[model samples]
Target chain A: MTADMTTDMIADPSGTRSPGEVLSWSRATLEPALRGAVDTLPGSLRHLVGYHFGWWDERGGPTGSAAGSGKAIRPALVFLASRAVGGDPLAAMPAAVAVELVHNFSLVHDDVMDGDHTRRHRRTVWSVFGVGPAILAGDALVTLAMDVLDGHPATSVLAAAVQDLLSGQSADLEFEDRNDVVLPECVRMAQQKTGALLGCSCAIGASFAGAEPVRVEHLRGFGEQLGLAFQVVDDLLGIWGDPAVTGKPVFSDLENRKKSLPVVAALTSGTPAGELLAERYATADEDLPGLAALIDEAGGRAWAHQQADALVEAALCDLRLADPAPGPAAELTGIADLVTHRDS
Target chain B: MTADMTTDMIADPSGTRSPGEVLSWSRATLEPALRGAVDTLPGSLRHLVGYHFGWWDERGGPTGSAAGSGKAIRPALVFLASRAVGGDPLAAMPAAVAVELVHNFSLVHDDVMDGDHTRRHRRTVWSVFGVGPAILAGDALVTLAMDVLDGHPATSVLAAAVQDLLSGQSADLEFEDRNDVVLPECVRMAQQKTGALLGCSCAIGASFAGAEPVRVEHLRGFGEQLGLAFQVVDDLLGIWGDPAVTGKPVFSDLENRKKSLPVVAALTSGTPAGELLAERYATADEDLPGLAALIDEAGGRAWAHQQADALVEAALCDLRLADPAPGPAAELTGIADLVTHRDS
Candidate 1:
């Protein structure tokens, strides 16, 4: 899995590249391949999915700016893991598309639930298309994800992958209203929400390539760990990163009184600052600056960062164990670095 | 088809039938089967899906009023069609549940879009659970629906069914925004929105039983025609049925500007009444009396009923050509009659 050999990675001929450069390169290559599948949609539907992906203008024309399509991190991990397991990354493209579609479906619906107006620096699907069309679009995407997976290698394996995605999504939803959500609960949610898709990506890739059972299991473990690490890093950035880089307002989660991993950890941390932060969060909409201050003072931020570091280390260790093909494995290693270190 | 044989047509021998009696009976029979396939979900997720189905209340206790699961029309169609094709209906239960789950998933999302507060005479999932969780619930249902099909039948057939579902849903979303909808387009929308699922239901049922291609084609045709007729009749009811009996506002389609089939037909009718109906429909609001009078005076309601009658006749004609197995075919005939005639 050598990143240097990948066409997507090759787009940056400049010898010097930042971690962000790696993320963008991985995403850039993956986007068109994904768009290829979406382009196959009926013309009426093709534009709608395209709009949701932020590739189309409001009137359903192409927008030209390809920057806002979210980091295609999950798909890249999938492609990398596929090559790592000795499979062609292209063979895993459908599975990669499936996982990404599922992720976007969640985002569209989440925006509606949170009453959010903007995503990727523009109006959300619900905001632009209205709630009915937005819900239908999300529904269509979910069905499309499964439809994409239908061409996967075997019935049994595909069935298991579908089950994993559903179970993960179910757990993530359950955690939303729960005021008592704990670190363990959040970890479990991570497994379902992120880990399941990652695991499926690897498993489907391995199955498509006809890898042995031992290799499939090993790749699955690598992806599960990597997915958890990815979520941990995302949670960290959600609270502590710059608004400009993340394309989100500072302390946005606190404003929504969301119960992310860090907030949950602080609530049960048992320190005075932790207690104060918990009290502030309990009120839902206390002063945003004061809440951020309490969370930082409580050491919640540090604890979250430390946890992310540990998980990333664990993920990398598993990646080594999977022993991927040279080209894809190298890409996976770089992605693991990018995932854990991203400021946004 | 014998009215006595179809479950819905039978008077409750137990004398316990209620508003959601069919829904309750179907759930009791279906849940165990679904649980058998999805055995690995962690406890919390298992509970979340459970509550979504109304087997449990919001706090995770059994909801005493568990009767209102849904109409179960699609699943019952699957089972009945399987039987009518000389296959074991029990073997097709997975397919039945899968189709029903997808149907319910669409309904939950649809309710949110339409801003309808009640379903089955109870609060809709989105209204009760909030939009985010409802979206997740809908997503989980779709994922599970695919999984259910993935395990029992031919993988290729199941995959095709999922693809059709997605394509259909995508068209449904597009239709909502287009004001120039006409009869042909409405028929095409009906095929995508309703006929496709029913066709898949029959196709999967045949697949589950490993029926011959000829038999599968016949059942598919039967399901498609029956579904089209069902949608046509529903359009009539939407405009003309008594609000009290329908559990929906009278001329709900006019009020919401739903672009229903009769409305499309009326728009194309070019009669003086048709022209007036169109004018009022375009600006539908609380002037319900005026709108209702316009539709009745313009012959839109009568025209809708006639169109439904024609479709029902055509559907029955198709069923006759199929020569379905006597017992289940008889049941489907009766079910079709019930569906087409019901005010609701």
Candidate 2:
């Protein structure tokens, strides 16, 4: 399609490309293959799928949808891990495409289950096309992922990750009805919901490279820790990041009453702010700056930052063990740091 | 696993068994593997999956649940087609289990989509577990199916069938809200919704037997035709069969305003009855006996029966090119007849 889609992360054989370039290159390289896999559906369904990808509008004409095709981080893991393990990154296209497909599948279904009408600053699949088609489309994407990555290890790994994802989602839904969700349980949910696929993404890339079982496990751990760190940083951003960059009101998680890790931490802090926030949470009114101050007062923000840093350190440790190359290893570590340290 | 789950359809290799006995035997043989695969899920989710399989109740006990394990027809196709092609049906266990899982996945999602509260005389997965858990469970089953049956041909075929099934369902949902549905479109939709999975089941079995491409094609054609014929018979029974046998009120398709094949055909028949039926459909309060008389008077019942029989004959012709053994061939024909000719 485009020259942009032709550049691979491996173009930097001199070991000098920045991690941002690596992520962008991997996204560009994987774009055509992802589109090709999705375009195999029959006409009408293909249009609906394209709409979800933000490549086309409801009328199937390309224009003006603001839905960014995600950050491509998981797919980056796939390609980089494959190349790091001495395999051709291009040879791992199927694995890369599979993870991206599964990631989008989860996005569509989660939007429906959460009843959220908007994502990526655009209407969701269910909001646009209705629940029936949205559900079917989600199912189609998952099946197509398997269709592309057909065979052992990949299929089992993807399926097991999906299992964990669903388990995490199940717990998340149940948590909505209870006020007793602990930090560890919430962390486990995040690991399964967000971390499992990321971990599997790296494992799949390693498997593509014919890496040994232990090596694959290490790469998976690397990605798993990265995934958990991403969630923690995300939680911190939700609560404390600038409204201009984060695109939300300050301390919005407090108003939204989401059972985020910081909320769990603050509730378990046993401080007067914890009791006041809990009271406000039950009453649907928060003391704004006071609630924000209380979360910080209870060490929630600082704790999340520490956890995120620890996770990134753990992730880098595994990455060093699994990938001895200076270039790809540096790129992976850089991307991890960028995500953790990003204001938005 | 019990002795029941251990009995293969080929256990009666002596060729004395009726087709019904063959189906029952195959299902029994596949039961252990089926249970083993489902039991792979984590504890709570496993219980939910088990309940959907009619293996347990909401309380996770084994008794007092009126649910029947499904007819296992698609799975029987996998096992029987394998044996008919001179292979051990037992070796196709993975394929058989995969098909069943996909079928149940569709069932769970479909029940939620259509808002049908009960199936096979039991509450649906969603009705018991809520929509989110049910949706997750359905997704889990599909991923699990692909996981177990990973690899070329099988994975691609299953994935494609899943796509077709979703397309058919999308069309079916749209058809419900439209008034211009024609007979051919309805038939095509039925082929996708019901026929695709069946065709894939046979194809998977053939591939498991390492059959050549042409042989696989013929077996798939046979299964596809069989699936189409099944819809025609089911439509006929829904409209005109005896209430006691069909398990519905007399001529209930009219009462429900469902656009079944016969209704679609008769609405386009151009007879006085067709005009009257069309008008009555718009009004939504038709005289039951009069609507029934009109449909039959317009030759709707006869037409469906003819279509069913012709489709079976077409299916049989393909079977003739497939298994040349008199015994297994005759058994397949018998099963086809049993499905097509039954009132319910």
What ranges in model 2 sit over 4 Å off? Answer: A1-10, A64-67, A237-257, A282-297, B1-10, B64-66, B237-258, B279-298
Could you give candidate 1's per-residue lDDT for residues B163-235 as a string of tens digits?
5555555555565567677778778877767777777777777767777777777777777777777787777
Share of reference contacts found in each model: 0.51, 0.59
Per-residue lDDT, model 2, residue B143, is 85
lDDT of 2: 0.81
* Per-residue lDDT of A142 in model 2: 85
Clash count list over all predictions: 13, 1
Lowest summed lDDT across 10 adjacent residues in model 2 chain A is found at A1-10
Please provide TM-scores, in order, for all candidate models, with all chains considered together. Answer: 0.85, 0.92
Please give the lDDT score for candidate 1.
0.67
* Candidate whose TM-score is highest: 2
Off by over 4 Å in 1: A1-33, A151-179, A284-286, A323-330, B1-66, B151-180, B212-215, B242-254, B287-290, B320-323
RMSD of each: 5.0, 3.4
RMSD of 1: 5.0
